[model samples]
Target: MILAIDAGNSRVKWGWHDGADWASIATVPLIEFAASSDHINPFSITHGDPERIVIANVAGEGAHQLLVNWTSIFDAEPLWLHGEAERCGVRSRYDRPEQLGPDRWAALVAARAVHTGPCLVVNAGTATTIDMLSGDGVFLGGAISPGIDLMRFVLHEHTGRLPLQEGSYRDAPRNTLDAIETGCRHAQAGAVERMHRAMGGNPLCIVSGGAARSLLELLRLPSRYIENLVLDGLARIALSERAVTR
Candidate 1:
């Protein structure tokens, strides 16, 4: 059994894989865990212990230590993944390969494993990252921008009148709230379309993260949504020959 953890900016997601497939997958908001005084291993209650545990953390050192403390009961020390020059059939083209985000690296690895052709990997979370992978398993770099929530947050924080409110998407928004919502959503979709066009090979966009559904209807390209993409990639890395703790 292998436990793979993705400690992202806004949430902590994990999956339990039994060599072949996932036995269980779970997600928890960072705030929920942070606020709780008792840091019990939530998954262990239902799924029991794992023989090996691997993690890809992008939530800074504080969260990293929190996770270390939380998973202390497990027998295996958590194997933290870092972006490498090449791993699991995917080669990095970035000048500073190690500087690439672990979540993005994991996603690209997962994309290469599943798709042979050109791929546009989109992870729409607290911040959105759109990465391009070539047909021959080469990661050709990517773009990063504020995600939907961050867009909305900046508008509210930077401006005096804009309040943090939920509004439905509208093509031609008449109200202020709707306009804000539409503009943010449009920004996300537009970036994706531009990247897809720039990638130039009619790449299969593998969409994941919390805001994936929001962009699905807006995307015009051939896109597939995987709910637990980072987790899947972590599992693949856990089983790979090159998977090592940094």
Candidate 2:
């Protein structure tokens, strides 16, 4: 079995593949990750030990320690994944490829494997990333902006009066909470729509991340939501690595 982990800013998603298909998949909320010792045991307890552990982590120092602890628990050293200049049929267009977030890079790699045409990959997790991939597998790059929650939080924390509000998406909202929520959603959707147009107006848009569903209905263009693009990418990278070694 192979353990594929995508540790983002807000959550840690994982998948177990028995060299064929996913045996199991799950996620751990990062809020409780620092405090919970038992959360990492489920995969091992239920599926036994993984032959290889791969991770694409962008959670910073505090969360990095949590992943380290997880590996220690299993006596396994994780194969930390990075965005390189080129790998797994995807070429980076970034000035410095390594600077691209591993999550975005992995998603692009996976997207190329499945998408044969132009595609815009939107990963709306802690941050909303809009990356464009050409039909032939060139990472043309996209946009990165504040996610819905972070947008609300920034307004509340940075400004003196705005409160942390909760509501739903609306084009014209009445309440303060709803207005804040709508604006955030609008910002996210707007960015996505803009990218879609920039990508010749009809690229295959693949949306992923926790807040994907919230923005799905608002997007002007149609999109397909696959909840685990990062994990899927990580799994593919793991497979490619093994093949190269053998």
Can you write out model 2's per-residue Cα lDDT over 77-159, one digit (the tens) per residue?
A: 68888879898889899998988888999999888877878899989988999999998889997899999999999999998
Q: What's the TM-score of each model vs. the native?
A: 0.95, 0.93
RMSD of 2: 1.9
Candidate 1 residue-wise lDDT, 169-223, digit = tens: 9878999999999999999999999999998978999999999999998999899
**Stretches > 4 Å off in candidate 1:** 242-246
Residue-pair clashes per candidate? 0, 0
The list of candidate 2 runs beyond 4 A from truth reads: 38-43, 73-77
- Distance from true location, Cα of 226 in model 2, Å: 0.6
